[model samples]
Every structure is written in C-alpha cells, then in structure tokens.
Target: MNVETQKVKIFMQKHDNQKRALISILQDIQAEFNYLPKEALQDVAKTLEIPLIHIIGVATFYRSFSLEPRGKHQATVCTGTACHVRGGPKILDEFERKLGVEAGHTTEDRQFTLETVACLGCCAIGPVVVVDNEYFAHTSIREVGSILKKYRKKEKDNE
Candidate 1:
C-alpha cells in the first residue's frame, strides 16, 4: 500500500478506529505530517466507515487544521486593536522582510511561517510575538533581526 495508507493504518491502530476519535486521529496525522494528505484523508474515511465529506468538513472547519504544509517554526504576531496601535503592523512587516515571506505564508526553506492573529489576549503587552512556544512582548521593529537570529541559531544548533 501507499505511504499515506500505511500512516493512516498506524494512526487508526493508535485510536482503535473509533469514529468518536476522528479529531484525535486527524490531530495525530497532522502532527506527524505537518498537514493532512489527501490520501490519508481517504484512508481515514474508509477505515472509520465515515463519509468523506464529513471528514473534510471537520478538517476544514477547524482553524488548527491546515490543508497546506507548515514550516518548522511558527511565528505569530498579534494585530489586535491594541497591538495595531502599538506598531504591530510595522513589526509584521519587519518579519516579512527578514524572513522573506509575507504573513500567512511560509519561507521557501520551510524554516519559518509568519502569521497574524487578531489578538493573543495580552493587550497590555501590545505588539506581542509568539515564536514557537516562546513569547516576545512589546516587540519593536529594531528587535526583529535579533529575535529571528535567535531562532535561526537555535535551528542551527539543533541541526
């Protein structure tokens, strides 16, 4: 069988092919592949005896699920009203310039994906940036280079 089918089998085995665990199964698949492959989705439909449309609906309905591949590092800039007034747009532009990818897109090297959020709920710390799981509060354009450098360094070190 194809690799996608094999992967689906493994994830199905993990969840015992229970229909109730569809979301959990999809999560495991996404965690393994960064995004859900179409073939895997088909396998899931067949394995769980669920309608393909239902599976597609659930996957598309969830913002956490990505139909496209994501980068190794996820960088989110808050563009809420508070953050907007605090130079958030400038910070996002700086990231786009430095990373060579616009917001909502990943770098060609797949090292970083830049995204903007309506709010991170840390309005007091306007213009916040969350890279991976680390938060950088009160960020400024001048600090963008250093912040990206730190992540790049970490990536290199891990390599």
Candidate 2:
C-alpha cells in the first residue's frame, strides 16, 4: 500500500476498525495530513465497509474537517456579535491584507490558512485571534502583523 493508505490503515487499526470509531479515525487522518485526503477516505470506506457518501457526509458535517489541504498553521478570527462590534471585521481585513488571502483560503506559500469563527465564547475578550490553538485575546488590527510574523518565524526556524 502507499504511504497515505498505510497511515489510514494504522489509524483504523488503532481504533480496532470498528465503525463506531469512524470519527476518531478520520480525526487521526486529518491530524496527520492536515485534511482528509480522497485516497485516505476511500481506503477508510473500503476497509470499514461503509459507503463513501456516508463517509463524506460525516467529514463535511464537521467544520473542523477539511477536504482540501490546509496550511501548516491555522489562523482563526472571531466574528461573532461581540467581536464584530469590537473591530473584529477590521482585524479580519487586516489579516487578509497581510496574508494576501481571503478568510476561507490558505496562503499561496501554504504557510497559513485564514478562517473566522462565529464566536470564540470569550466575549469579554472580544476580537480574538487563534493561531495553531494559541489564543490571542483582545486582538487588534495592529497586532495582526506580529501574529503572522510569529508563525512565519517558527516555520523558518523549523526549516
């Protein structure tokens, strides 16, 4: 089997190949690949004896799952009522301008994927920006560049 398929099989094996563990298996696959690859999904469907449509349904049902490849880092801005009133749209616009990509797209360099959440549930800290699970509370347009720089530097250092 190819490397991707092998990885999917391993994830399935980890969950004992039970249908009930489908979500967990898909999570494992996404965590490894940064998205649910078509081949991996097909392998999962065939191995689990589940319909591909059902698998796709489950995958698309979750906002966390992405069929398309995502960037090395995920940057999410809060745009809920509280955040929106607190310059959240401006913050998102700054990010889009800095990253040269829209909110729902990944950068050309594949370093970051920009997204927006309705609410981060931290209303007191309105206008929150999260990068790779690190929450930046009370974010502002001015802070956007530094946030992108921080992640970009990490990518460079890793290289």
Candidate 3:
C-alpha cells in the first residue's frame, strides 16, 4: 500500500473500522494531512464498506473538512454581525491584500489559507482573527501585517 493508504488504514484500525466512527476517522485523516485527500477518502470507503457518496456527503457536510489541500497555517477572520459592525470586512480586506489571496483561498506559497467565519462566538471581542487556532481578539487592520509576520517568522525559524 502507498503511504497515504497505509496511514488511513491505521486511522481506521484505531477506530476498530466501525462504520459509525466515520466522522472520527475522517477527523484523524484530516489531522494527518491537514485535509481529506481523495485517495484517503476512497480508501476509507473501501475499507469501511461504505458507499463513496455517503463518505463524500459526510466529508462535505463539515465545514472543518477540506477536500483541497490547505496551507501550513490557517487564518480565519470572524465576520458575524458584531464583527461586521466592528470593521470585520475591512480587516478581512487587509488580510486579503497582505496575503495577496482572497478569502477561501490559500496563498501561492502555500504558507497560509485565508478564511472567514460567520462568528467566533465572542461578541465582546468583535473582529477576531484566529491563526492556527490562536485567537487574536479585537483585531484591527493595522494588526494584519504583524499577524502574518509572526506566522511567517515561525516558518523561517523552523527551517
């Protein structure tokens, strides 16, 4: 088996290949690859004896799962009512400008993927930006560059 298939099989084994553990298996696969790869999904369906359509349905049902490859870092801006009213749109715009990629897209360098969430559930901290799950409350347009820089610097240091 290929590396991907092997890895997916391990995930399935971890859940004892239970059909009911579909979501959990997918989560494991996503955690490994940062996204649900097509091959991995196929392997899952075949091994679990589940229909491919059903697998796809479950995969697409969750906003957290991405069929396409994501970036090394995920950057999400909250755009719910409170955030919107607090200049969330402008903050998103600033991120798009700085990253040179629109929301819902990954940068050409594959360093970051920019996304927008309806609400982060922290109305008091309107206009929140989360990178790799690190919440930046009360974010502003001026803070966009620094945020990106912080992640980029981490990448450089790791290299």
Task: Provide the lowest-lDDT 10-residue window in model 2.
Answer: 1-10
Please report, in order, the local distance difference test score of every candidate based on alpha carbons: 0.91, 0.92, 0.93
Q: What RMSD, rounded to one decimal, does every model reach?
A: 1.6, 1.3, 1.2
Strongest candidate by TM-score: 3
| lDDT against true structure, model 3 | 0.93
Off-target runs (Cα >4 Å) in candidate 3 are none
Query: For residues 69-109, what per-residue lDDT tens digits would candidate 3 score against the true structure?
Result: 89999999999999999999999999999999999999999
**lDDT computed for candidate 1:** 0.91
Residue 133 lDDT, candidate 3, scale 0-100: 90
lDDT of 1 by residue, 54-128 (tens): 999999998678877889999999999999999999999999999999898889998898999999898998889
Tell me, by lDDT, which candidate is best.
3
- Give lDDT: candidate 2, residue 102: 95
In the predicted model 3, the residue pairs found to clash are none
Error of 3 at 110 (Å): 1.5
lDDT for residue 65 in candidate 1, whole number 0-100? 80
The alpha-carbon root-mean-square deviation between model 2 and the true structure, to one decimal in Å, is 1.3
lDDT of 2 at 105: 89
Comparing 1 and 3 by lDDT, which wins? 3
